[model samples]
Target chain A: MPEGTFCNRTPIQSEKALKRLLEDTGGKTYYQEMKALEVDRDLLWGTIQKTLKSRLRTWLGICAHCGMCADSCFLYRISKRDPRQVPAYKIQSTLGEIVRRKGNVDNAFMHMAMETAWAKCTCCNRCGLYCPHGIDMGVMFGYLRGLLYQQGFVPWELKIGAGMHRVYRAQMDVTDKDFVETFEWMVEEYEEDYPGLTVPVDKQEADILYTVNAREVKHYPEDLAEAAILFHLAGEDWTVPSSGWEQTSLAMFAGDWEACKLQVQSVYGAMERLKPKRMVGTECGHAHRATVVEGPYWAGRPDGRPPVRSIHYVEWLAEALRTGKLRIDPEKRIRVPVTIQDSCNYIRNHGLKEITREIISHIVAPGYFREMSPNREHNYCCGGGGGFNGIGLYRPQRNQALITKRDQLLATGAEMVIAPCHNCWDAIRDLVEEFHVPIKWSFLKPLLIKMVQVPEHLRPENS
Target chain B: MYEFLAGPMFILSLCVFFVGLLVRAIWYVRGLHWQMDRVAYGMYPGPGIKGAARSIGYWLLPFGTYGWRAQPFMTVAFFLLHLGAVLIPLFLLGHTLVLKAATGIALPAMPARIADFLSWAAVIGIAMLALRRIALPEVRILTSAYDYFILLVTAAPFITGLVARYHAGDYAFWLSLHMFFGEVLLILAPFTKLSHIILFFMSRAQIGMDYGIKRGGINGKGMAW
Candidate 1:
């Protein structure tokens, strides 16, 4: 998320894209269009202003600003505990600027405010649990970000995300054939680790629908390999579809609510066809968090929402451990101290945090977890999820989030940081390098396999 | 020349102040394009009769089923401030009240007895709130000079009325002068930060029921608490 041709490409790219869309759309008014989306503008919205007042006033009255929110903000932790970098201040001051200007402001002011709003926060809501006064900054910013996106004010990388979502139907430009090919590749790679492994495509009546964060197919292919390896070793009947395989949803974070609806529809449509007894959301935190819970909720479920069972990777893996089907080798790991990062989305309403510990304890000793200072339910973001890592405009904000993570890693004195999700791994890895912090990042499953104490008698053929 | 300028200037200020504020509120209401879906991230289920009914409550009762409705103390404060505001205006010599009720008996100590006590008590109200505005971090962050001025203008008529009543000698003339300014405060009350007096109930009622009921829910992200 740092130092690309972002600045150079953004100006022309944004200008051209905005002009192109507005030109094609026939003079759309952004605000008017947003208020009454998917409807004709000629229909008079009599209560439109009344709706705006309640929303704006609620937004205005929402924040209690106790600074507990500072704990969850990635920027504060990454910036070595600078208070200004905390998420609460970002909301307070940005909204304060809007109020001070009486909502009539220039683009420069908006640019800075939007950066703070969109990038500085991961929309994780870890802090939301701790709040004595429940103000949802994630929702506030999400709504505003959606409005901004309509105005062509989204981050640089996310333009591509929106495009991918629009055309290719994935977070990245992942296609149906590419998805199938990757699964075929993963099956071969996984066999070296766990023999007789098979990842099926469009398999009817599978017991589980396992969704991988799209990052697995693109950059973090080892995760897919690890997932396949683990699932095979555990002897679970899971299928990764050629269609509904990619699950890391940037749309949830990009504030593209419509896009989010479309995604859930696509994923669920595939689910209805496969008829999996349960859906296993992968190690990606926000993806799982957004998909099963928020996505279905947002879509209105107008005629009653689908009731697919949703479980976290940790919970599923922990269940796998109980079955005694999965085992790992501890000697392959770095053998230094390590701690698990509890992804906010998976932990809160889903309670995957404890299960993550259950996972680490199943493989490594309890003492290996040095903990992330303000850890567990109160964990700071890794400056990644909620589309921040995918957004170029959020580089500095994401960099700020990296500050606390760097400090935390330095304090842990651990050799490795086990982040369960790909985006978290990416953010942690970037910050670890960017801040010159001496720590390596690993997905929990890979590290878990590394440290699972693979007996010398049952070593892999390569070993 | 002096009389022409003085009378016209005073009239112009009153007219501009009152009309400008009303215009602003009207413009905001018209421009905001507000609705139930807009609030709480479109969280309100907007339960038909139940939803509308839940938003309104007995003004005198605390814990009335409403989002921003007044509690007993706040309601008392509301009545005192508003009653004192309207009643003070009624007693002004320019109003038809004095001419009809008094006819000649010198205006009943220029604002009677009960109205006078609340006037003095209002200073305490203003002070308590001003202290609150200064002390609380949330309130303090949102404070402005206009807020202070509005407080002052609000307390002004009461202070001047009290002073004019007890001061004697030219007290009647001073009372008349107090009445004139008191009327001015009323003229501007609905527009300025004073509007919060009327607005606080609406805000509290909707916000209350929004968070309170499960059936009528609000959608949106949980805030960065």
Candidate 2:
């Protein structure tokens, strides 16, 4: 609280340690690769000129210098009140400098801007909530990312992931054959418990078309198993498309509009062919919001494509419960107290907090479900939302910044922390491990699978 | 000097202020081009307009926003500063007499006691903000020379007017000095950060509209209001 005693509560990482960690995480190597790229001033200036619309122009001009947003930033708080970590300072340094230079900045300046845009800020938009003017920092960072992407200054992981999505239609390059095989494998695995289980693939005109993050296929296949079990128990007509099953988009985070369109079009194009009534995107916040909320704008369609409405996984679950398709036994709920880390994309940006709370209230036993303070839209980000999970450059700083979130979770004193998002799950799990926080972490679906009851008629005959 | 101070110089500054504001308005609006492409899902005008209405009150009241709830001191300081700045100038009996003499337009003025309280309150508010900007390292880093200069320019009229009222110096000289600073501020308003007078409403409304339509409601979690 006092001068020189700021941020004494948390262990802020030193610059030397951060650079060392960047080298250790191979972020330094990536920076060197970035420096090797050809610099184009004309294209950079043209992009800035095109994107500096009136809204952003006004925000840049009208900041009152009250510093109300400083307390709202996790990075600034965790970094012991570092001036550079302040959200306004970060924006003023990058976009402010761009405006000052009138977009005619050199390569050296571009490199610095890219670091601030991609590494320093998470683009979570929490600052917007605390800003009296309600400046949308997330959208501003998004436009900044767009400008950076135009100059081919994207992070290595995002560039590669976007390329994979363009060519392979999935982040991990999971082919059609492999995707079907994985679904079949999940069906076989779930059938061991619920004998009549089926993981339908390419089923045309199905009521629900389920999509997932490719990481489920490459790393956490059990999440797919959980989905298969839920659908089977509900007896709903759901199918996974063999092609375009991947819904995650690196292009959205990287701010590559062309690639974003290509990736979204691939999924919707496949859905248009299959003709499902609705598409249930898996528990990946960025992908869910991008596909459902932002796809219209990115694709240049004013009216969003409505034939197959894209819904978050929790929405699908809430609908199932409301319709009596999926039943849960209140008695079978987990005994340990649990808290939620509201994904910024889903809750803050999209207004899914109420429904999320509704679902959690039903799933967790009454005494066990403790709501984290600043729970709903006001929740702190998990430090991984804006592709920070994949970008190795800021791993050390990110870990340090995550202390605020870690503290929020710790304050709840819950044994289990539910992150209904893949990125948040990874980030929360990492912080739990790093800080030695005595809590288990999970995605919402897996926990739901544990408590949800399969009807006797839907269950296996023998078991 | 008094004749010029209250006559042509005042009218000339008022023209600069008004014309400059019009130019700024036109330039900002003309540069605005909507991209029907990326407006988020569920974005519609009904919620945006309603949200803008609610947001006007939300932002106008100093304690009505979450930022104020989080940092009450800063919020109070700003509220006092803006309240004094806008109200004292518009309602002061001295200014009303000047306006009546200049344009043959008469308007009611606040009681002298209330005007005195407002003037001193505003001066104190300005001092607090200036001290915070200069003292707080986080805020200081973003503070430009223009920021300090504008603070001085706006504060000079209030300070000199108070001094002239008390006859701290030659009454006419102090009054002339106050009028000169007041005219300078009017001339500089549109071109400097002082333009926030208009931009605050415009920018806040646009943000409220965007958030309201995008999220389908004005009241919800994480909203500043």
Candidate 3:
């Protein structure tokens, strides 16, 4: 309610002011620009009226004001049971109030709602499991974010993320050319170690069309090389599309629905063009959720499926190990006490809980694998889903949210943590970094590459 | 006055309850677009039905779900209040006699003593729920004036009926008050948050099907948690 700057930082007051801010987009950072952007009441109301459908309406209507959802949320628990952190209270106060008032809310109200939507909840969908009424406040928060985005009330990083997808069709500025070239370069770097390893690009009618997170291309291209080595060792026909290679959708986190459609369509278009029997995405949680679980609905696929049969990297890995195509060297298997971070996006939302376990059984030595209490679908989010990790404005809250996960990991007395998804990996990394927890974390690929048995023929001559 | 309260007023309340709920259901369904909403439910009918059944079935039992198990006191209070609200009306001898008088039909009735016990149990349950709304910070924040009003409206019949049964006050006054509050509850059920009575099933089914069909929960795949 402070008057100087809306939400204490943004000076936006009217639609015209928002328009002027939009025109000058380059003078300051995206966050600074966002702070100056004004509320667009008509657009917000129009979106609410258009998108507030029966699922949300019934959900909003039937919430019994039960605080049972309080414990289901890690934030509420971690924040010392702050009433505002309660999942039901968070959604009810923000989205519920917006709907109750029919979008007649002001900038301060929108900003508060934005904070709750981004910082308070991770859209992990765990509360949906706990609610007797099945209210799914996480889903409602996602819907609320769409309304906030329409009013330009999103966080600076997410706004920039949405723009990246809009302009480059990737989360970061990694172009289609950059993704393919990076994959080829990474494969070349590993070719000396694993003889005859090749990066397949846009191979038509391949059994699997491999996709990857843009972060892998921009920052950790070794993920691509490891994927190639595994697929090559498995002797499976796999191809990565030259374009549409980026699998993660920050637009989803931004709640920019159009950009979500655009990003997923790029991946779906790759599937249509190459016509792979199935598509296997890299080890990223929300990427799978964005492109596989929720992507079909965004793309308006009738059967609620991607163009090709899409599976997570864990699914592919589990299958490869089960079929004896990829064998784990028993001596090389991880001997240290290790635990798994069950990513909510896939494990809970997509039902891939056991598949990850299947991969773990092969990679970890017997009796070395430890399970986090309240694991799998009921597991706490890694405190970084729904774009929480990237937003500087909510960094402190995001860091605090990790306590639930930090304790869950520490309880296992594990030295290493196997986090299969990129979001979980980043979060667990940040958690260890922030809390100085002794546990080390790695993606399945890094550990798998180390332990996977190299076929005699594929091995380099000197080795 | 007894005849009028038991006959015309009771019928009117039932009519409003049924017709209002029907309208609400229609309005809810009308808001859903087939392509946008229905398609997201996925195409696996077997898993969808199984998920829906499991979700609703588990929730109906005492200590059935993880959420219920987390809060022991609230679970006990909730089930007690809901069971009395449902069973007392259907099986109590006096209510059955009224129904028989109106429709020439008979329903199996519970012993008068047992019905009396249930009424008290329900009253206690209501008090417990009301106490949490006031005492628990998390629950209190979400509670509004309307929530307390709804709780009062919901508890009115059982409390008044108990008073009438014990003859603790003027018998005719308590009986008439019980009948009047019961009628008010029926009329308000569909319009107020009490709509959760019916909508809970629909909401639970939607989420179950969503998880089942789209997420492989129907095939018993990832539901380990």
Pick the DockQ winner.
3
Per-residue CA lDDT of candidate 1, range A158-192, in tens? 54565455555677767778877887887786676
Candidate 1, superposed: residue stretches over 4 Å from native: A1-56, A62-106, A126-132, A302-307, A327-335, A451-463, B1-142, B145-225
- Per-residue error (Å), model 2, residue A68: 2.3
lDDT of 1 at A242: 69
Error of 2 at A76 (Å): 0.9
TM match of model 3 to true structure: 0.94
Could you estimate the TM-score for every candidate?
Answer: 0.63, 0.91, 0.94
Off by over 4 Å in 3: A1-36, B34-39, B222-225
The alpha-carbon lDDT assigned to residue B139 of candidate 1 equals 46
Instruction: Tell me the tens digit of each residue's lDDT in model 3 across A1-463.
Output: 2222222233233445444444544324455544555666676778888878898988887888978899999999999999988898898888888888877888678879889999998999899888889888888888888788767788867766777777778888788899888889999999899899998899999999999999999999888999999999999999999998888998889888888888899999999999999999999999999999888888888788899989999999999999999999999988999999999888888888788888888888899999999888899999988999998889999999889999999999999998899999999999999999999999988888888888999999998
Model 2 pairs whose backbones collide = A297-B37, A297-B38
What DockQ do the predictions score, one after another? Answer: 0.05, 0.40, 0.63
Please provide, for model 2 over B84-169, each residue's C-alpha lDDT reduced to its tens digit, 9 standing for 90 to 100: 78887777898888878887778889999988888888888889889889788778877888788888988999999999988998
Report residue A155 deviation for candidate 1 (angstroms).
2.0
lDDT of 2 by residue, A38-79 (tens): 556666677777768777887888776667778788878888
TM-score of structure candidate 1: 0.63
- Please name the candidate that would achieve the greatest lDDT relative to the true structure: 3
**Cα-based lDDT for every prediction:** 0.57, 0.77, 0.85
Q: Write the residue-wise lDDT of candidate 3 on B71-105 in tens digits.
A: 99999999889889989988999999987887677
Q: Model 2 residue A194 lDDT? A: 84
